[model samples]
Target: MKRVVFAVPGSLDTPTGGYAYDRRIVAELRQLGWDVECLNVGEGFPSPDKATQSAARSLLLKVPDGQPIVVDGLALGVLPDVAGEVASRHPLLGLVHHPLALEWGLSAERADALHRSEQAALALAREVVVTSPATAKLVASDYGVPAERITVARPGSDPAPRSSGSRNEVPHLLSVGAVVPRKGFEVLVAALATLVELPWRLTIVGDLTRDPNEAARLQASISQHKLTGRIAALGAVPSKRLAGLYDEADLFVLASHFEGYGMAYAEALSHGLPVIGTTAGAIPDTVPQEAGLLVAPGDAGELAGALRRVIADAELRRRLSDAASAAARTLPTWQQSAAIFATALEKLA
Candidate 1:
């Protein structure tokens, strides 16, 4: 049987965009008749300590000789030494969601180290698969990977029932992402505070435990803005619950610092909810002007203005919502993505 090993970081069940993409791709690959073996190298990756690094190296080394091995970029980017050794012996492919060096809040030295390491590791890959065209371009320009060897299989979105906007006086806003600095939930809060006169409630759905300190800080910010009563920080919920939130939302917004592929924005469009986000990274590619409003990243005033325009103008919101639903129909499916990924893997042979 045709087979391949997919080595990923721990917490395969995590309710994050990258993890979700991994899970869906793996399932579709198996259904397509490829024996996909998932190898869970230890977690705490992209910043793993010595012990974790050792454990990950050992696990990766155990794969049979000459077998095709695909490593998640979260793990692959930090292990250049191991990648060089393995790629010499096996058909190694690196699956990158985004470059780790682009993450927010990294020290200059650390970012440079990560960039150098990732560039070296990706250099050894037979080819690289990225989640979006933006990332493919980054891998080529920033990571020194050849553009020809990169394949872009944008994350797929499942069709969803159109959102039934809150049939009430107050509109409900939803934002989904990990409660981390990079996700920029704090920026969203700050922007929302400026529009206190508008009757809108914001609900942020994400893994609060991923960064407890950030969660605490966000809570404090809410209290400081006296928006504790208007904003609800519902930590990560199951897929069903998230769909329910989507159905209840009038608009979707996330002021992320950057995104390789903004899966949440796509999901919102699938649910027929108009989007309001920053034009950071792949966001503009994921969300267009017809479906939503986009502003400069970290600009609280701009975000507030965009939100006000959407909230106060029901006709405009309705038009954007219809456009979102139309765009959703054109999104790639998991099946199509899997077919492209399978073809990319076939090239490794």
Candidate 2:
């Protein structure tokens, strides 16, 4: 049996797009007969404390010589020394969702440090696998990784029954993602505030615990807009309940500042919900013009204008809904993504 070690920073169960991709890909690989060993290096990665750094260093150094290993880029990107040691003795593949340095809301110094460390770590890998072509290109151009050495395996979406959609006279808007600065929920709130005269409600489903300060500010924004009753921020919910939300929602919206793959937008398409997203990152790549309307990342006026147009015109909404469903039908499956991952690993081995 082919064997490989998959090293990641945090719990496999963390509720976010990147972690979910890791978990699903790992499970699918095992189902296809790979003996995949999961190693959970302690958290606080990309900015680890001394204890976390020591533990992660010790674990990577102990991997058997000549073994093939895949390192989650979140952890591998920051540990240049450990990655260098591992690469000298074993084949290493770096799985990158996005460059940590490109993430929104970071101190300039911190971003620069991450960019340097990640480049050093990625340079040690035999090859790199990214979740989107945009990321692959970014890694090549910005990180100095060779274009030929990077492979793009887009995130997969499962088949879902078309959403029944909202029956209410007022449309219900749904947004799914972590409530952090990168998500641009503050922008979403501001945009929605402008359209308050319209009949609609918003439900934000995401992890509020990831950034307490950001959450506090978002709460204040909601309060300032006096949208306390119309907008609800429900922290992360189970998959089943999320599916229910998708089914009940009339429109799916997320004003993310950036995305490596924009998995949520694809998932919304699978549910046959028209999407409203920003043009930043891979969003334009994933959300087609026919399937949804996209505005500039932080442009509140544009977002509000787009919302008003979509909500006022039922015929346009229906057309977009059909386009979204057609787009979803063409999305790659989890099994296919796993096969890609397996093939990439085999080439390295």
Candidate 3:
């Protein structure tokens, strides 16, 4: 059997999108009869302490010489030493969900540092894989990677289960994403504040990160607006429970400033829920116009208008829900994603 090693910064338990991507890819590849090995290089990564670096070096030394390897670009971009160790001896492919430098909320200095590290990692890989065409262009134009050397392979969503009458009692607007500035939760809250008289609720799901200042600011805004009762924060829900949330929600909204590929939007569509997303990053690629609505980023008024329109018009909501279900069915499955990835690896090998 062909052997493949996937090097990632965190395990499946990590809640970030990049970690989710690595977990899905590795599982899918294993189902395809490939011998897959997962190596977790710890949390601090690319900037590991001296002891962590020593451990990572030892881990890399154990990878079978000349075997094909796939590196999570988000993790590898921070750890050039790991990339250097594997590139010369193996067929190394970098799977980049999105360039770390492009993430929102970073200071200029941090963004530049991430950009430099990403470029260096890309330079070391024999092939690069991105999730969307937009990302492909970013890699080619910004990172100087040749277009031909990069492959666009999208992530897949789980099939919507048979409805078990799991819908919610009240009309609810749901947003699923980490509590970070880039997610634009503040915008969603601002939008919700506009419809204070309406009989509806808004739920924001996902764990709050280490940034206390952002969390405090959001909490203060909610308190200031007196939206405490109408809005609920349910952090880090399990996968099974999340599906129930999607089913119960009347509309799934993502007001993110940017996304490489909007996984939550796709998942919402899979559950036959209409989506409201910003026209940033690859959101336009995933959320079709007929499936839901799109507004400018950080435009709270427009977002509120869109939300109201979707909530008030039952016929429009039904139409969008049907369209979203159809669109979701067209998305590639994880098995298909694995096949595409395997083909790319074979060609590079």
Candidate 4:
């Protein structure tokens, strides 16, 4: 039987985009009859200390010989020394959702350190699997990975019911992502503050606990903007509950600093909710122009203008919604993504 070890940084249940991608891909691969073993090499990844790094390396070293080992980017990028060792023993495939150094809120020195380490780690891999073409390009051009060695298997979006829209007299805006600096929820809050006179409410759904300080900071920002009364913050929610939120939203927006594939934008399109997001990373690749409006990252005034236009013009909303439904039909399914991923894995044989 064909089998591979998928070594992830932490629990498979982490409710972020990267983990969600890992979970779905693993399930699809198993459904396709691959013997996929998920090895949790311990936590505190993308920033593991000496003891944790030693322990993680030990766990990875214990994988049986001859099995292809697929390591999540979060763990793989920070473990160059271990990756070199792993490459000596097994076929090492690095799965990168995005390069770690580009993440928001990192200091210049820290980002540079992560960049150097990730480039070194990726160099030793037999294959690199990225979730988007943008990442594939970045890895090849910036990380020095050969273009031929990379595969782009973007996250799959499940078909969802078109949003029935808000029951309220005001439009309901929805944004989904962890309450981290990268998601730019603070930017969203600042943008929304200028549109209060325009009848609209924003609901943000993401993991608040992932970064408590960032979450608390967002709360303070919301309070500062006097938008606590207009905005709803729901920490991590179950998939079903999220689906329900999608069903009720009039528009979807996320002012993310960067994204590998912007799964939330893909999901919003799938729900036939017109999108408003920043033009950072792979967002433009994810949200079709006809289906959404995009603004410069961190530009609150630009974002506010886009939001106001979308909120005030019902005809524009209808047009974008129709286009969004069209775009949704073009999204790949988990089954198709799994098939592609399987083919990528087969090439390693």
Provide C-alpha RMSD values for all models, in order. 0.8, 0.8, 2.1, 0.8
lDDT minimum window of 10 residues, candidate 4: 340-349
At residue 307, candidate 4 shows an lDDT of 97
Question: What's the TM-score of every candidate structure?
Answer: 0.99, 0.99, 0.93, 0.99
Clashes per model (N, Cα, C within 3 A): 0, 0, 2, 0
lDDT to native, each model:
0.92, 0.92, 0.81, 0.93
- Collision pairs in model 2: none
- The residue ranges of model 3 lying beyond 4 angstroms of the native Cα positions read 45-54, 162-170, 210-212
User: Which pairs in model 4 have colliding backbones?
Assistant: none
**lDDT per residue as tens, model 4, 15-82:** 99999999999999999999999999888989888988999989888988878999999999999999
Could you give me the TM-score of model 1 versus the true structure? Answer: 0.99
Largest lDDT belongs to which candidate? 4
- Badly placed stretches (over 4 Å) of model 1 are none
Against the true structure, candidate 1 has what lDDT? 0.92
Model 4: lDDT to the true structure: 0.93
Candidate 3 lDDT (Cα, 0 to 1)? 0.81
Candidate 3 least-lDDT 10 residues: 161-170
